[model samples]
Target chain A: MTHGTTSPHPAEPAPAPRRGRPRDAARDRALLDATLAVLAENGYGGLTTAAVAARAGVSTATLYRRWSSKEELVIAAAALHGESSYEQPGTGTLEGDLRVVLREKAAAMTGEPGRLIRALIGEAAHNTALAEALVTAFLQPLYDRVAEVVRRAVERGEIPPLDGVELLGEVVVGPVMTHFLLTPRLPEDVDQATARETADRLLPFALRAVGGTP
Target chain B: MTHGTTSPHPAEPAPAPRRGRPRDAARDRALLDATLAVLAENGYGGLTTAAVAARAGVSTATLYRRWSSKEELVIAAAALHGESSYEQPGTGTLEGDLRVVLREKAAAMTGEPGRLIRALIGEAAHNTALAEALVTAFLQPLYDRVAEVVRRAVERGEIPPLDGVELLGEVVVGPVMTHFLLTPRLPEDVDQATARETADRLLPFALRAVGGTP
Candidate 1:
């Protein structure tokens, strides 16, 4: 069926009234929520558009109209989920800014975002398309935000203009990522307290690695 | 059909003549190799003991005699593959020792071990057993080795006795792991030159994080 049914104005509609803008936005949210649920349950290998559609209480046709494939759907959902996870913090010092960033990351790691991160890492090894999408949609933005934080630090004279400042993202988050994602601990075992502790412990090293006095 | 066929002393008048010790060792090696091959091709989710047995040119029954389950088989195979990947280096200085370790790790990341590592990580997100196996069989030993390197450095008064020296393993390897595994680069693109470059770039940071003078 056409998308004209949810038009805002039927009688005085101007070419189908933007074709269900509001309703489609709500449906897209539902579909993305369903996608995450299915991904958490079934993982990237097992996730199917049909399963996501069914979970969302929509027909596969409706789901396909928005996202052409499961990869597209997952990428969209992950991007949405991770969009607010990293914020460019201006805490006036490199250490202060990174502490805020790491705390937020630690908090995020104790929840669904953490689980999704693990699953994405697991699948990205084999799936090049998903890997590229994850980099473009999630990691690139995170790196850019971190670069912004470093740039602010440099401007403040908190740290000198380093040679390899771009490597700061990996240096800052790598240990924390290894702790939560690569460690043997199960997701349930990774609570907020331990996550925060790990973040606190690694922050000094991160600062040192970033060429700051910790 | 019995393991008695390959007995070294068929007529030794002992019960089953130790059950084909030499031949069984060889067979076990073949089975483990086959398990890694299947794991690389099918991943942890798609691996089957039947497929491993077929690849090894042995019966499933024969495979089961050594490892009872696919998890056991995979763990054994992974342990064997990763066993030689780490060694305790006594390069006198922490930097020299860590340099060797990181270079070896970078080299290992470009080959089959790297691929298997990525696959295991992907499956380990959802599979607690595999995750535990990886930690106990792979990560713990690697950590122990790094700890040894740090301990030697401490003994030589290279760095003061750090409180959280155990975290050195994660610190030393985290950025490298993030660069190779978590980034968008495909496995084929992670060649020795780039891997070495990443390891070299992160080396000074690692030393600094470990409280050593870079």
Candidate 2:
């Protein structure tokens, strides 16, 4: 697969489609949905192009025409899932926006989506393709959203225009990632309440890290 | 496997040996060593009791006598590996000590031990034993060491007496972890110099998080 930001897969075309038959949005949606379903049940290792095709009621040729490999398919599916789950809550203040976003992020981690994510994390160690796909499809978009939040915060003078402010997403959510993903004995439910509380506690440190008045 | 801290296996008795032949420390050492070797080569799923026994030149019964399951044995081996790798540095200041510890921790993550850790993190999602063991054996001991450093810093007035100082380890290392474990595009070698630089950048934030003067 060609490296960098552009994904060669038909599902996520590198550029605008030329001609040929215009891409079927409905069929593409079905295939992506089927891919996630297979991943949720069978995990990254168990995911197969043939199975995804069968689940989508499409031929192997159709699946292959969109994605060259299972890795590309899984990545596209994960990206689609992330896009659907992610909501840009323009809550005015930086803290308010982050609180909503972080809560949603934490909830996703504890819910069904989290299972697929964990399975992917495990499989990524062995499959570089999957690892790259995870970062490109899942993490990049989330990072962009976080950067947008910080940008607004900077404009409002809540956060100082520090050099590391651009990378504040990692700093802000590092503790959450450590808690939800790395920590074994997670608290009950790991619901929106828990996420909100965690975000409240850690936000000051993140603010301070970016030279903001916490 | 019996629940809780106590091991039910004959080779891993809760108390001192009663009237049976004295347990061979050398043999136990060899078994643990063999277990890690197998893990480093075969990963968590591929590791087997038979393979470990064969590598250690011990009988399958002998291996099973100490640890009833593959999860238990891998946890013990990983615990042993973590213990050996973790070095406590009382370098006068909290920053100095953390710099050393975090640097070492980062280097380890980019090395052989990291592979096993990644594999376990993946497997632990589904396996409670592995998750519990990861927290108990690997994370707990390291957390203790980190807490000690913060305690000394607080006593010295470098950091204010804070309620959450006990969790400074998580905060100090959270960003490093987010960069190393979560990010796919790792820098070259993930060298000690880079680790130290990252620790330098994040330590002030950790200090500030605990109400310290950075």
Best by DockQ: 1
**lDDT of each model, Cα atoms only?**
0.76, 0.69
Candidate 1 lDDT by residue in tens digits, B182-206:
7666655677888788788878878
Please write out the lDDT profile of model 2 over residues B40-150, one tens digit for every residue.
787788899999999999999998877888988898777665555566788898778777767767766665566667778778866777888888776766677778877
TM-score of chain B taken alone, every candidate = 0.86, 0.80
Candidate 2 has an fnat equal to 0.37
| TM-score of the first chain alone, every candidate | 0.86, 0.79
**Number of clashing residue pairs in every model?**
1, 0
